[model samples]
Target: MTSTTAPKPRLSIWMRIGAVLLGLFAALLLLLALFPWDALREPLNRYVSERTGRKFEITRRLDVDLGWRSAAVKLDGVEFANPSWAREPYLVRAERAAFDIRLWPLLSGRVVIPHLALTSPTLGLQMEEDGRRTWALGKNTSDEGTVPVIGLMEVDQGTLDFLAEHLGVDLHAGFSYDSSRGEMPLDFRIKGRYQRQPLMAQGRTGNVLQLNAAGQPPFPLEIDAAAGHTRLKAKGTVAELASLDGIDARFDLKGQNLGDLYGLLGIALPQTSPYALSGELRKRARLWEAAGLKGKLGLSDIGGDMKFDQSQKIPSLSGTLRSRVMDMDDLGPLIGLPPTERSAKAIEGVAPPPSITEVKRARRDSGRKVLPDATLDFERLRAMNADVKYTAERIRNVRELPLDKGSVQIKLKDGVLTLDPLNLGVASGTLAGAIRIDGAQNPAEIRAALEVRGMQLSRLIPKIETMRTSFGKLDGRINLSGHGNSVAGWLGNASGDVAALTGRGQFSNLLLEFMGLDGGEIIKFLLRGDRNVVLRCAAMAFDVDKGTMNSRSVVLDTEDTVFNVSGQASLSKETLDFVVRPQPKDKSILSLRTPLIIGGTFAAPQAGLEAGSLATRGAAALALGALNPLLALAATVETGPGVDADCQEVLAQAKRPASREAAAGAAKAKKQ
Candidate 1:
């Protein structure tokens, strides 16, 4: 009871100095294995090259395994000559170097990094091609500050080769990191293979990245990435990222067959058909400018919004796009047309004696129409906000022809281009119109007007294959106006007016079919099943600059034949000249003055019927008196009466046969 009981609890004095420092660390690991570790290998290679400025070589079996808190140094190679970047010197070549120097966690101060193993490591990176980048840590070692954190590092099965001559990349990677969370917890894994496929990634950060680290969440982070068929995933939280001054991100990206991620990043990307993306990104930072970005993108079904200014070099964009229906014959191989069924089999392989100045320059270039460079610009185009629709069963140049419905909307500023008035129902009629295009200047001007109603002259004459003419239940109404700078000066300054009404019709070979004549005699006719053949035309309002088509009236009806047709058509060049006069249903039956030369070139025309019938004008003066047999002895010595008595009765009726049987019975009664 001497009350000095505390004297009994005497394991004190720092427990006898931790039992003599654990028996002097077990006798210095048994005298460091019989001592002669090559005599401490030159002061442990000058203390690992003065703490890793990097250049050390010490290997001859120096292994200290104090009950497995190991240490191994079997490295016959170690060279890191990047005294902060020359051109290419970040050399790291290793073959086994394991270390774990745990001296009771540095005598309980606790900054334990108990393991670091590297085996077979070789890393190389270089970039130079005017865009110089050889990261042996230079640029004055990144301006001499902040880059010294080598905690928890490991690499196994490692091999990395990267080259980026200004982005003509070549990369092969495999990496990993773990910090064992004594202070802030971090874990990372990266796997690789480039051109030959396979790549993977994983990440976790901060408060042991939660798994009951007391439900940790101070700065959670998650990441996932893949290669080959590409994929990416991300999760956020960086503790308000420096007070949200920058780096707030959300992302999701997916790709499968993005043409195999553009052939594993060699990039050529335009064989379109499989895509995916998702997004949200916001960034801000400024201290003499360095970061600012705003983004929202959702692709492959399109969506967009973007802005950038921190070295993103002038970017601005806004977007809207939706597509479901498309196929205007695949737009003729994207506008190099000549495939519309091979240009309609090259105009049906034309070869029907065709060369009347090439069929009058193919009918004066048939309404000369050509327009396609693809521009229907819109600034405020609203076809009900365009959820527009389209469908097609047929679209033809070689004849499928049914395009039952259509839609259009267009608008353009300053130079005007507006067209949103189209009400269509084609293939036998019901079309409406609206047009305006005045491309401001230089060879651009057009004014359109199309109004076709109830039009089925055999579905608009097979789209005018040079109008192989047809007419059957066609009620017409067409009014077209035009201005030009091309398309043959807009059809030589077009002027149109056509009115047709047919219940039944036939007019074949009008001098071989409407003045294309060619060896005529194929004049079929039938349009009087009850009178309605009327053609009232106009062009001579002062020759309309000589495009001439003035036939005030051309009436012809026939249940029993009656003709009173007047004409004056001179479509300029390529044959169609008329002066026909035949008004006979007994007006003393002596009216026939056909001096019609329906010329040529509208595809083979040549009709010159000039026999004004008074008996071939006396048999053309007896064949010019037998082509001057001395003018047939001067016409038989002027067979009396000044040798002109109607050419001596045309050589006495050319030895008549009842006046050639009454002129072949009145030309077979005037062709029935």
Candidate 2:
């Protein structure tokens, strides 16, 4: 500095840098003002085409309006070709498009659109089962950038077509937006086929420009849609509309059967009657919930909270369900029965749906059947897993059994289903059991064990007035296993043991006389009216092999009479062949006793005296009468040689090893 003397005042480095930057800015502005963006259109298209490995072109004029911090771009015609594997030729086609983007964000690797408009634009999207997606523009090099921000957007005559082979979805959607409508700025309609079923939907939503806004506000929405016979109406708000990340809504759902939803939502459900449900629906990234669920399924009222988790490799469903009033008839579909027409018709007072009608027709063609035949959808069972708890406070419409409250814990995993602790109140007692079904096998396998305790005979036979004053109780047990996909098939091939017994109690004398065919007591009871009698013990035991049930021991003993039963019932043929022999403890007048025969199909049972036994007895009576009129009565007199049953032994035999194994399996599964 001393040597330079007064040569000059040194220029500061800051001033020099400022002057250089000012000159560069001026040069940039001049270049932008004079440049022809149309001339660069082909180059830009080529660059984009090379990057994406797709054809890209600008068919008409391309222009840009330069600004201090933003730029407005306009294109008359644009088109982007689709992948070679796509069904459509083009991925995008637009007659005209324009947008204003902030310039500074680009340097930071962000896209910020201040305004955007599209006219006569069409987009095509395709997805495959192997994780291929058309809309994903080039390779996903990184997951670093935030989603683009858009301030305002407008669309006119825009349409899109989407196909997803993995989901069996094909849809054509039309969308429009109007900023003039502040509350609802977007409108959309979709018509397609999902899971091979016709689908149609229309909805209104909040401004699409705010989908990625900084201070996120609730996105309002309303939708009305139908898929096959399933219908849904929803109204709600979402935290993020772009990804549907968060949602809170209310919805009403009506469907012909709950099982039908498997196709629409990929959720496995047991077949049910026509149903109408309403509830609050909520969703997170990978979870959905239906809370405060209340609805009517046929004649039953059901309410609960359900959660669906899609975070797992296979989706899962969990819930606690309750029914204040459950109509037993409405649950026919659980064991694979066709939808009950009575319940279906009662829901809407209308004819049953086509699906139900078809099922009914098939059932008719199959002829009369006592057990359910509808096959379970094994694939559906494998598609997802579930854990559910259900409780019924009251039950009605049970014809044969007096069922009261009931509860069960249902679990499914890897195509295996279990209903553990399936407890049901019957005749003021409980029928508790466990059942397992393995759908992984081709023909399927089933194991079941059940026990009955403290079932009051008075409540069981309420129709018999004389039993009301009696103090008899019944207990029973059943253990079975089989390979089949249907209730009928399972029972037809089942191997099992069944036992039932009753200890000392009082019973109806008139009923006992009828069962034993004691003419003397029958006439006496008719003359003096019915009365209670002491019941010593009753026991029944059966062994099932190859679908045939053979009576091991069947006996009933009372103060004045004893009855024994022996025969085999063929479950495969649905036939019964049994013989009943009765003996009296005391002699009586006009006691023409003979073996009673029961022989016929289950659908049409027949009971009558054995012809040969009756003939022999008649001949003996005739011979005795010829010898002496008083001696004739001796022909029908009983020797009172019948033995009583040991109640302790009968009950102990009911606890088979199979039952113990089933119980252990259920406990293990519960712990798991």
Model 1: colliding residue pairs: 509-512, 509-513, 510-513, 516-605
Q: Write the per-residue lDDT of candidate 2 for residues 1-672, one digit (tens) a residue.
A: 356546544676778999999999999989988898999999989987886678889889889998979999998998988878887787778998898989999898677886767778888888777666665556432222433566555566688898986787999999887778668778889999988899999988764434444455676888999988898999988776555667899999988789989888888888888888999999988899999999988779999999999999989999999999899778877787666667876556234654445665666544345667777788997999999999999999876788999999999999999899799999998999898889999688887878889998777877775444475788887777777888888878777777777888887878877877777778888898888888887878777775777787787778878787899898878899999998777666666668889998876789999999889988988999999989888887766565655656655554442344333432332232
Point out the worst 10-residue segment of candidate 1 by lDDT: 534-543
Best by TM-score: 2
Cα error of candidate 2 at position 228, Å: 1.0
Query: Which residue runs does candidate 1 get wrong by more than 4 Å?
Result: 1-25, 28-69, 72-87, 92-114, 117-161, 164-233, 236-250, 254-257, 265-270, 273-276, 279-672
Clashes of each: 4, 0
lDDT of 1 by residue, 1-672 (tens): 466534555567778899899889888877875666556667877775665455556555454444454344344445444434333455455666655554555454333333445666666655555543333233333322322212333454455566553444455555434456434345555665555566676765552222111222345566687765567676665423323333445766554333354446432221222235556655554211111212111111333333323332322112222223322333332222222332222221121123223433556564232322233222212111211222223333324553344444444334444454655556666566655555554344555444556655556555433434344444333332344443334334434432333333443323222232211112223342112222221111111222333443333322222233344443334345555433222111112223344555444556665556434633544665668634423222211111111323322322221233323322222221
Count steric clashes of candidate 1. 4
**What lDDT would each prediction earn against the true structure?**
0.40, 0.79
In candidate 2, stretches whose alpha carbon ends up further than 4 angstroms from where it belongs are 1-7, 46-55, 65-72, 83-89, 99-117, 130-133, 136-154, 176-182, 207-215, 239-243, 349-367, 466-471, 619-672
The alpha-carbon root-mean-square deviation between model 2 and the true structure, to one decimal in Å, is 4.6
